[model samples]
Target: MRKYIITGLLVWLPLAITIWVLLWVLGIIDGVFVWLLSAVQAVLPDSARASIRELHNIPGLGVLVLVAALMLTGMFVANMFGQWWFRQWDRLLFKIPIVKSIYSSVKQVSDTLFSSSGNAFREAVLVPYPHPQSWTIAFVTGKPAGEVGDQLATLSGAASEEHVSLYVPTTPNPTSGFFLMMPRSQLRPLAMSVDEALKYIISMGVVAPASDALSAHPAKQPAAAESARN
Candidate 1:
């Protein structure tokens, strides 16, 4: 009886959680649609409002509306005039003192994450952290830029050597992490893709990428050769 019950739960638990999550998200989106409908109905004649009362209860309407709005925005932003307007809008945002700082930082991060040509998170790496011989998986964001790179070079007395920026995400919650800048020679590049590494991290190493995959991608190369190739 115990085995049967455990097996049944194993089969059903994931399905139940997934359904619950989907329903919860749908309910929240539907609430937005309901609020918007109520606002519009406030100014409408009673008879007209009554005629459209059924629309207020429609599930997933807000999701549809949100998708449509995003599509329209994308279409609008694809043109020359739209690009000019966007630049002007960005300028206006930059004029605000506090808002500009927050907005600019977020925009830069989003651009790097979403840009097609961006190199952020392109490779997975391993580096010693907290102590020697203890290593953690990290994502290579890019090379350190501007003053940070210069300062690191000066401190290390290796102005000619390149330093790469990495994010070492914590297990189970990959969103929060430490940002590190280390010389390229120290990082051990891994064969795993960003998605595969993420899965390993999020699963707390229980789910690992295949070792065979690493065979095709060498983890280490001579620093001199790497610098020369780059």
Candidate 2:
């Protein structure tokens, strides 16, 4: 009976969790849309409210609208006039005292992450952090070009005039992290794919690569060491 129950759990657990998560997300988005519609309905004509209600009743229309809005925004930013307008708008926002603080902060974050020329999360990398033997996942954002890299190289007495800025992201949540500027040679490349590395990190060392697993488990070590010696 216990064996049967365990097998059942293994089969059903993932599906159950996936369904619950999807339902929860849909519920939250639906709630937000309903609230916004209600707010607008107060000012809308009774005939218009009928159309709004009909639109809301169509499943997944809210998500479609959100996707369409994002696509439209991308299209707007692609053109010459939009680029000029964006700069002008940014200048105007900068002149406003209180708004400048908030606007600049948000703009910096968006530009760093989303701009085509900007170098955040450009290349995946591996970095040793906290300790020499210990390592963490990182991304190679951009090579330090212009005066910054040159000044650093001169100050450090480096033979090469190159430096790079790397963005190190924490697992389970990839949004927040520290940025480090280091010499290119110091960074090591990992054999595992990004998804595999993420799974290992998020599991907090419980999940390991096949090579690592062989080294860790006692039963496998003697054979592995013998093979290495040969």
Tell me the TM-score of model 2: 0.71
Off by over 4 Å in 2: 1-4, 116-119, 145-151, 159-161, 205-230
**Backbone clashes under 3 angstroms, per model:** 0, 0
TM-score of each: 0.84, 0.71
Give the per-residue lDDT digits (tens) of candidate 1, residues 84-136: 99999999999999999999999999999888899999899889996768999
lDDT of 1: 0.87
- Please list all clashing residue pairs in model 1, or write none if there are none: none
Identify the candidate with maximal TM-score: 1
Q: Write the per-residue lDDT of candidate 2 for residues 1-230, one digit (tens) a residue.
A: 99999999989998999999988887777777777878888799998898777766766666666788889987997899888888898899999999999999998878887888876755556677856798787777777767877677786557564667887777667667788887777777554545556667767656776666434444424454667868
